[model samples]
Target chain A: MYLAKIFVTHKKSILDPQGEAIKNALHRLDYEAVENVSQGKYFETTLNCDSEDKAKQITDSICDSLLANPNMETYRFEIEKVGD
Target chain B: MKFAVISFPGSNCDYDMYYAIKDILKEPVEMVSCDTESLDGFDAVLIPGGFSYGDYLRSGAIAKFAKVMPALIKFANLGKPVLGVCNGFQILTEVGLLPGSLQNNRDMQFISEYEPLIVQNNKTIFTNEYEKAESIMIPIAHGEGNYYCNETELESLKQNHQIIFTYENNPNGSVSNIAGITNKNGNVMGMMPHPERAVEKILGSEDGVRLFTSILKSFKGGILVE
Candidate 1:
C-alpha cells in the first residue's frame, strides 16, 4: 500500500484572503520578516496499488477529477510506501 | 414555461427558487434530484443557492460530479435557458458550463444583504424585461462570491456582451465588478445574486420578478404581449 500526501493551493495570480488574514495576525505578533502567506488544502490517502508508478497515476487522476479544481487551484503530491 | 429546480445535497435555497416560480410566477416547476440521469421535460433549469456537499474541497466542487450534472450539461448544451444563482453560479463554473471561478469574498466575510446591480446587457433572453443600463436591487448572500477570470477571457466577455450584470458597488473584489455573466452563447447564466429571493415585495424587493418574466417571454417568443 502507498500513501499519497497532496497539497493544493490557490494559484499565485489568485488572491488568498485567508492567507492575508493569517499574515496580518502574524504581523501583530511582530513577525516582521514574513513577507507573504498563501493558503491551501492538504489530503492524505492510502491507495492499494501494484507499484509506485501505479500509485502516482491514481494520485494524478484523483487530483485532476476531484481534489484540485483546475480553474484556480494547483496541486502536488508525494507518495510513500506505508504498508505491506 | 416548465422549470426544474435542481436539488443537490445541502441545497438550502431550492425551496425559495421553487416558491419563486410556483407561488409567485404561477408557473409549473418541480424539484429534480441530483442523482437523476436526465432532464427530459424541463424547459428551464435552476440551480439555486446554498452550500452543496457542505462546500467540501471548494464550493460546488463535489456537486459537479453529481449524477444529474451530466444531464445539466446536456441541457445547457442544448441552448436552453439555465440560471444559477449564488452557489449555483459556483457549480456552473465548476461544471464548465460557464467561464471563470468564484473565490472567497475580498473581505472574507459572508455578506447577506440587498445590493444594487446594473443591467449591463438586456438583449439576452434572461434580461429582456429590464431596460439597458437599468439599476436594480437584489439580495446577495455568500462568502465566496468574488468572481475571477483571465484578462483574455474578460476581454472576450466584454466583446461578446456576456456580462449580464455588474455590481453598482463592488462588494466581493470581483474582476470588473462582475456580478453575473452569461456563457458565450448567452443561454447559460450564472450570477451571485439571489433573484428568486427578491422575487416578491413581501420578501423584500420585487426587482427579481422581471428576471423570471423575461424567461417566460423567451419561451413565448418574446412577444411581450403580457
Candidate 2:
C-alpha cells in the first residue's frame, strides 16, 4: 500500500486573496513585519496495489490526473509494507 | 438563438441559466452534461456557476478535464460565444481558454450577495447591451473568485480592451478589481458574478436579461435566428 499526500496552491505569481486577508489581520493584531501569506489544500490517500512499484504508479496517476493541478500544485508519495 | 449550458457534477446554477435562456430570453437552451463529447450545432455555449466537481483539488481544476471541455475549447476556437460564470470562470482560466487564476476568497468563506459591476468593454458581444462604464448589480456566490494575472498580461489585456467588467466597490481582492474579462477574439467571456441568477425580476433584478438579448441580437444580425 502507498500513502499519497497532495498539496494544491495558486502559482507563486498568482495573488492569494486569503493570504492577504490573513496578513492584514495579523497586522491588526500588532504583529510586526509579517510579509506575506499563501494558502493551499492538503489531501491524503491510501492506495491499494499489489507491489510497491504498482502502488507508486497508481498514486502518481491519481494525483496528477485528479488530485492536483499541475500548473498550480505539486504532490508526493510514500510507501510502507503492510502486515510486515 | 440556440444555446447550451454545460452542467458539471456539483454545478448548482445550471437551472438558473436554463430559466434565463428559456423563460426570460425565450431562447432555446439545452442543458449539456459535462460528460458529453461534442458541442455540434450549438451557436453558443455557456458554462454556468456552482461548485463544479465539488471545487475539488482546486476550484475548477478537476472540471477542466471533463469530457465536455474539449467541445468548449472547440467552440471557443471557432469564435462562438462562450461564457464562464463564477466556478465556470475558474474552469476557463484553468483550461487556458482565458488568462488569470482564481484564488481563495479573502474571507476564506463562501460569499453570496449582490455586488456592483462596472461594464468596461461594451464592444464585446457579451456586454454590448450595456454602455461602457455602466454599473449593474449582479449576484456573486463563490469561495474562490479573486482574479490574478501577471503584470505584462494585465497590461496587454488593458491595451486590448479584453477587460469587460470591474468591481464597483472591490468586494474581492481581485487584481485591478477586475470582475470579468473576454478573450482576445472577444468570443469567450468569464465573469465571477452570476448574471443568470439576476435575469428575472423575481430574483430582484433583470439586469442579466440584457446579456442574453445582446448575444441573440449579435447572432441575428444578417443571419437566420437559430
The local distance difference test score of each candidate is: 0.93, 0.83
- Which ranges in model 2 have alpha carbons more than 4 Å from their true place? A1-38, A43-84, B222-226
Candidate 2 has which clashing residue pairs, if any? none
What class would a CAPRI assessor give candidate 2's docking? acceptable
True contacts kept of 2: 0.42
What lDDT score is found at residue B225 in candidate 2?
17
Candidate 1 has what TM-score?
Answer: 0.97
DockQ of each candidate's interface versus the true one? 0.77, 0.36
| Cα RMSDs, all models | 2.1, 3.9
Docking tier of model 1: it is medium
> How far in Å is the alpha carbon of B193 misplaced in model 2?
0.9
- lDDT of candidate 2 over B21-81, digit per residue (tens): 9988898999999999999999999998888888866788889889998888988998789
Writing each residue's lDDT as its tens digit, candidate 2 over A2-62 gives: 5656566656765566677788899999887898877677777776767888877887788
**Top model by lDDT, which number?**
1
Q: Candidate 1 on B101-135: residue-level lDDT in tens? A: 99999998999989999999998888999999999
Ten contiguous residues minimizing lDDT sum, candidate 1 chain A: A64-73
